[model samples]
Target chain A: MPIDEALLERMLLRESVSEFLYREADLLDERRYTEWLDMLAEDYQYSVPLRMNVAFGETDAREETRAGREICWFDEGKETMSLRVDQLNTGLHWAEEPVSRISHLVTNIRLDAVELPEVAVSCRFLVYRNRVADETDFLVGRRKDRLRQVGDSWHVVRRELLLDQSVLLAKNLSIFV
Target chain B: MTTVEEPTRTGAPQVRNLVDVKNGEISREIFIDEQIFKNELENLFPRAWLFVGHATQVPEPGDFFSSWMGADPVLLTRDDKGELNVLLNSCRHRGMRVCRYDEGNTLQFTCPYHAWSYSIDGSLVDTPGALHGVPQQKAAYGTNLEREKWGLVRAAQVHNYKGLVFANWDPEAPSFDEYVGDFHWWLDNLADAFDGTEGGTEAFRGVHKWRIRSNWKFVSENFLGDTYHGASTHASVEAVGIGPGGKGKRRHGERQNEGGFSKGRMKTSFRRGHGASDNLAYEIPYPEFEEAELDEYFVAAWEKRKEKLQAEGRLLGGRGPATLFPNMSFAAGFPRTILVAHPISPTETEVWRWYLVDKSAPEKVRDWLRHYYMRYAGPAGMTEQDDMENWDYATEASRGVVARRYPYNYQQGLGQETASDLDGSVHSHHAIAGEVNARAFYRRWAEFVDNLSWPELTELARVDDRATERDAVVTDVAEGVKVLDAVDVVDGPPAQ
Candidate 1:
């Protein structure tokens, strides 16, 4: 099928993709990180590029940069992402210690395009993180993802996050978006 | 004892009495006193070489970044002429901050209050009514009102040392070079690539800023010498494979004392409150690469530069952290990170951190370094969260009147650093083990806080070569070395 026709078809499946996203958010909020990892395809590329506060005329809305031109807050492959889970498994990574109470609110589901095995989806997210006694952070951003169908389940193949705040308001982003 | 009096009006304690480096004693009041905080803002911060953003941050003309010099909001900008200036963000008319955004490119800043606009170079360009005499200023003061004096206040001095921009508020203060003294050589190592290539070091985009409920001094002083807290504070770093304690692949955090992979350690202190503590032979702990060829390129470059660096004494070992007195500090090794601690109040500090790498390096190299920086030491990095916890509690505990009465003991390496061949530098043989640099830091800090004139402060900054010598053996070479080196040395530890 032509790319445009395929995208139109994917747009028809937006309901299913939104359901998949909500399910993913539920997994993350429950601290089911390993199970969350299971939702990823083998060739997953997860990244949270840095956002900056620049003049409107300077660039796009997020004022982000190309991959090599600037750096990101979180840019990890499947191995690196797995390593993060491994670090958490040690039960010592103090950043995650005391265990964060997170509520991942995913909304504004929009279908962008689709290829043979993957469907591109866009959405808005607000990850409310509360830790220990008083520390709390609200990370709101837009995420673009490529979800691939593996049997009956959707696996995240690629994801890019563009946060609204230039300087991260949270201490550490130990939780995935 | 030669006592340094505080400003008589504020009733602050005598500086000499406030800190006793010889006895390793420091009054907790210095960390929690409101009057002393006010004094520091007036006397110390204005005179110090406070770190601003890097020159590369505003590479294009009209580009700007807003930052704080102490508590004052300032705008760092590159004008149309490509000249750099630090302007007070407050408008002269209503004291409204003219620039509200964090960073941007603008030919001129217009005050939102009354539409008064000033050029990027801080020249008052338009007054909205100056030509037509239609509104506020002209109607109130007539034609005699001077517009020149109403321009945005600019920093007294602005200069870039190897692309690191710094600003001072006091015109009578010593030059940046004079203020930093010999610490410039140490700073150069962090900002420059091994080849000394032009435009080599550039801070990666986006800064990590976090507020800590602690005195700014605690953070800067930590970078100076207090590696003692590492073992307990960062015990988790090892439990994870990222640190040296584990027997895994060990890509980074080379475990300074686990197997004795180093030769020795040294700490250097200079005049004007600048000091650094580092390993004798520290290398970048982790260098992750996608291609083996890129890895080979880095190793080859390092091998070729090692001898030259050794000759210059810059290649002394695994790098550690250093502070340029008052507020600015740098992790003087791999994936070099620079930090500025802006004192917001007596018990609150806002810290700004940036990681720099070789600009000429490959994309993957820069990417790898940034990833390590964010994961390991950035605001949310593994190591930094541990430090924030400590600082937060320390500040909270010291708020009590009883706690403020006691002195924080800094006697770890008191009377220990001896004469060294490094030219006016002294080293504690135990390397990461002692509090040598911290003592010197507080001493110089006391000197800066003294009610002395500019000339007197300059005179006092001169180091006495004979004063640092001690007839004592180094302690904790075994324990201290391991605890300190277990974390980031290349990019100063996350203590700040």
Candidate 2:
């Protein structure tokens, strides 16, 4: 059976979102904060939940309980993002001071329909960061992004990055993926 | 007539005199030397009350999370009976990690290597291949090993105060309250400020783990004493108007132009290594929001705390910034807590920060606090990023042959430290510069590194003459506060 027009449109949206993500990665890797900032909505929300070892066979990968859900790290809004970008631009931001060359490879894009209009998009991503003075540290994770079509462009309303490793090898998370 | 015993161990030096504290700058050997590292793993780590995860991490009966103490993996789980248990993550048969994942809810943990299963309580439930292969079946493997004795080793002591869990390997260490000492007051203030009506606040998942190349002490000292670097190192933040503006512009309520503000801030250090710089009254300056907007929250919390203090017949007008000895530290009123844990070598440390908000607070308050915290303190936080860069460089620089030759100079305010106006608090005139807080930390470090028994260490600390000047200031301040209180009643509560 041929794909429906609505399905085709959805696929196009997915592709566009994926392309935008790659472009965003490129902007960050190339140190283009201005361009990167332009891509974000003024009220965009970004968060990376701390991954923990949950019991086997449980479907709820992210635990948000009062006691067990500790925030390992996160960025809440655009103002924070501006501060971070500004720090990076200056000779400050010691974590990334020397600046690590980063390559974010995003692949295996899969779209699952949870409900109409709000699709769950999952992609495999491997981020390699090479600090100028230290050994390279790599992070591989699955990005579960909630993309919404706001007019012509797709904006990331919510994103959950689930990293495979619980004990991270990187010294500090000064970079964003 | 006294006889001195000669040191038998080749690398082990004789116990030096307490007066030798002057020479006790942390040696790079503590970070790099394999022997010293081993000694620390055996001696320091196993003895101290190492922080584990918060109780919230394992909320439900079956909920569990895995963590590490040095190299030893441990599983923190809530059992079938809902009791929190910290168990070694090793299997009985071949010593494999029972649960490999970081956290989850489960009835039991099964070893993948040999299929040995264990209940959440660390009781061996089944040995898959034992009954069929062994002639004695249950006798050979199951019934022979006492399930209680053979199960995972529980931490020596696991306790929590206000949802924060800590475990110590030493059974004889001071009680949690005693170990916390004056730091307990800071924790109380923090817990009291929490807006959560349902007992305590929750940590959002997503730990940003990264390594820095410097000694663990460097990280601790940096956080403990280096507020001086904030304006200079984070100039970018100022340029972007995220943090304090450069030169004379005060970003927060902090009076950047006044020398006394910095000095008054530095003088606030608690006994037992807990200390905070700037904001002597444990209040984090709020430059982001207008005073009118913040007054409701701050005044309400402060008024409640003041009433509690008054009922207890204590002074509430001033209590300095907060710090917990060894690892944990916080700016309480700001509602941010940093828990720093040493994971591997002394040079390697893991920093975890929680943006604490009152549980009963409005969603907007929580959201705003989360936003502010992330902007300044989180892994991607501008200020934190600036600090991390310096940390990474400090670590890298320490590894250099020439740089290692010189001892890190923490003598910024050395002899000039003033005592707190209250008991068990120390102060410095300049909060921005490194001062008594750093000295206090190093003094405690010398005590720990010298391997003094707990009682002996406490005794020696009490008699140590270096703190006399600070102590005098504390006594005078306490007395002065008392006089101020008496006059406050007569003055009819001054102008608001």
Candidate 3:
């Protein structure tokens, strides 16, 4: 069967996709967590797997360093994430008691495949976070996300974050990357 | 300028001056003095059994993990024949670190500075173009430049308890068994075989590491006995209805009974300053936010492991924080954990934390435990943030000119130590507030700083558990206050 390039391009290559991702990053940077939660689907999953310093030549590195098998920074569902946000609002999340100032620089947005209402998107992100004076942390990573269309907007259904450092040097991962 | 005498200076504090036993005072110099920190590296670290990494981290041949023993970088490797080796990570040539990565599997590690390569067993296998690069390598280096003589420097002793790997630099230091002493019974509660598996506990995949601007001893002594700070330090967590406070709210509030009469709670000081704050028959209450089935799975797993625990007499009705002498600490709560601190300087430390779970438990149970560990104790954990804030401030406060003159008080429950049913342990009946364990720790520190012989240290560690013979003093500053004061206590009442 011949592929429908026109429909695929219309769903994935639309400018609205990149704009939506930019808006999401802005929401996080501004600490507008409650508003950002609206961008996630009802059954969304967010996870960041532990990166391993596997030897350069090892072929099974990907398999050995994936989610579920090894320890992770986060492997949260929507409900768990919601609880975290609610806790943050209580002003008792000591890691965030003073609130960290973050700049989420999201770039290199690319839409790979489109399947009806679902689209696969990937982007690079660099988050600079500062807590009070003399404390700062920078995180660089790539996120693979699956976004589902809800009315005129796209809701994040799944996200897998791959970080650059194996052993995090930062004091804490309290702020979102 | 007016003449002013320095409070005291002889590089390190004299053993007698460091701690005032009867007064229960600890000198601020030990925590902030630069020369004392350097002395510790030479006098204490080498003589202590420092934890490196777990055996499972490098289960197969050629696997390795880069770790540190105080300021010295070391590598933990499993050889082709399956023997574990702890080798200095620095190359014998030019002092370059041979392995740069945190962990990996490699048959040979090649130094980036000079292409000096070492085999998994830490033998200097090859040097790139050694014959051509410098004929002086044979002349200046002498005729006896043999590869066999240039092998990596290994720890004088390497041993594993359960799966936790430990190494020592001094050949004359006591064996791991002698060093651990009576804590064997308490340690088994956190380790030992699982219900359905042949192997005992195993650390989960990755280690959680972070830097803290505080002295390592602050962390070690806190976990060793400072249970009094829990309710107040972590009050925010309780208010937010999360973490240990939320799940075990009943136990958290009711555990403290004013004059320190908390049932099933006691402090056990083992030989060589190792000590633990224990609670008998501790319960793990599931939080309402978690899945309901998590409790059921945990109960099922606990039932299977309880039989072995009871048979060996290692099962405790309650569990709490414990310290293994110098720097290692154990949290024998749900999702068993070990926290190790590596001193970077007098006021800086790097902390490494590992979560140990029974391999035989259901996969779901293990997952839940892993989640609990990350959520409660690590750098990003809710509970850990509260403790770190206090420790950081404590370290900064010790640097004051006048403040350093006055010693920090460790007098609570000082004269209340009681004889224990467990042999070779100094037991304190008070659970929530007590300085008995900290006093024991500082006493050992003074012996080490004084450069006492192993025999002398062993003899010093031996004393009547029923009284304060080891804690007696003959100093002018000794203020003999026996009973614990109300202002010194903060923990709430015990659970129903």
The local distance difference test score of model 1 is 0.70
Q: Which model scores highest in TM-score?
A: 1
**Which portions of model 1 miss their true places by more than 4 Å?**
A1-19, A59-62, A65-68, A110-116, B1-16, B121-141, B242-262, B279-291, B303-318, B422-425, B465-496
Error of 1 at A70 (Å): 1.4
What is the fnat of candidate 2? 0.68
- Candidate 1: chain B TM-score equals 0.85
- Can you write out model 3's per-residue Cα lDDT over A1-114, one digit (the tens) per residue? 888998776755557788898899899988899999999999998878766655567626532344664567776677656656765776766667688888998888888777
lDDT (10s digit) by residue, model 3, range B198-298: 34778788777778888999889878867777666665555554432334343222223322233335566764788777633333332232455665655
TM-score of 2: 0.79
Reference-based lDDT, residue B182, model 3: 65
lDDT of 2 by residue, A62-135 (tens): 54222213454564666566666766777655567567899989999877654544556789889999977456
Q: C-alpha displacement of B48 in model 3, angstroms?
A: 0.3
lDDT-wise, the better of 2 and 3 is: 3
lDDT of 1 by residue, B1-496 (tens): 2223544665655665788876888878788878778878877887788898899888997788899998799999887667788888887778888887777877778877876777774243432112121147767788776776777788988878889999998888788877776667667777777454544788777777766777998889777756566655666654554432222433244444432234345566555666776544445433434467656656665665666676766643434577888788877554478888889898888878888888787776666676667666766566666677677668878889778777888776566665544434566545546677777777777766665688787666555442444443433344445544564352222222
What do the candidate models score in CA lDDT, each in turn? Answer: 0.70, 0.58, 0.69
